[model samples]
Target: MDNVNQAEFWQQRYETGSIQWDMGQVSPPLKAYIDQLPASAKDQAILVPGAGNAYEVGYLHEQGFTNVTLVDFAPAPIDAFAERYPDFPAAHLICADFFNLSPEQHQFDWVLEQTFFCAINPSRRDEYVEQMAALLKPQGKLVGLLFNVDFGRDEPPFGGTKDEYQQRFEQCFDIEMMEASYNSHPARQGSELFIKLQAK
Candidate 1:
């Protein structure tokens, strides 16, 4: 089994500051998406699994989103996030494996998939798709960016082509948008794909 499935492995990475994917802020594309959200969306139950630094969660809370849940395998980042946002509901910050989260107890209106999918074991890609479907309410959306280019390595942030992603995610989600990001961050300009899918 891949070590990325373990919490200890990720805890160590956070302790040593080994997360290169962390932009030290929310992803630009995601920020743009959040900026356009209607006032009615503030109460939607949202999940951000594998949320390392949880920058997106922070942004959501800052914008008055009341029902945001943040989950991370590692405790270090979660602890740091708690310190930064003391009033964020303590119960909403969960330090647990995303796959183990109970669908019966933790349903959501939508999920935010940042770098989480790429950080998991490639062998579990299908399982990820199934789990995401289970966690969402019917017609719930999963929106975020994915790497369009292969990183050619056997570690975290493992990348894949659009065809592979389309095939995998299409199993349980209705693909609304999956195309090259026109306004990605400078470093990710040509490498990212913005995807928005609804659970089907």
Candidate 2:
């Protein structure tokens, strides 16, 4: 799809408040992961793309992460998030396409994914993986959740299997972990995989 159309699609979802993917809070498994990270990691540059409402970003900020960035093309949710967290740095709230972000200009030590992947057009999966790799610093990690089952939808929340994800990501990342999350939110239980991949 063209840029204007893609932006409009997601924008309409936010405009209508039809975002079912907005978990309203950080996913439990991800919260646990954050709880265990070393304090020194607080300064690492981190990015969260397609970050609607951005509960995780808010959580990270509350936990004292100093360099967190939230990227979402949609303006409605971005505006809402800014309102909710007025103290969040305006510069860090990037309202831009994930694919358009530049590593040379916006390098990250890690990127946090929530439901962004399944929301994208499936044909762009390869480009998504490539862009993610390019956007990370060497050995940077992409850590977050992925759907393990099909949602049987024609629109957002597109889903896939583990084998497909492994094949697509393996060429550019070291798949350190991709398994059924031990502590997924009640609604997402058994259907979510927690992935931890490091740039190769």
lDDT of each: 0.94, 0.91
Model 1 stretches with alpha carbons more than 4 Å out: none
Instruction: Score residue 145 of candidate 1 by CA lDDT.
Output: 92
| TM-score of model 1 vs. true structure | 0.98
Worst 10 residues of 1 by lDDT: 1-10
Residue 196, candidate 1: C-alpha displacement in angstroms: 0.4
Which residue segments of model 2 deviate by more than 4 Å? 1-5
Total backbone clashes of model 1? 0
TM-scores for all candidates: the values are 0.98, 0.96
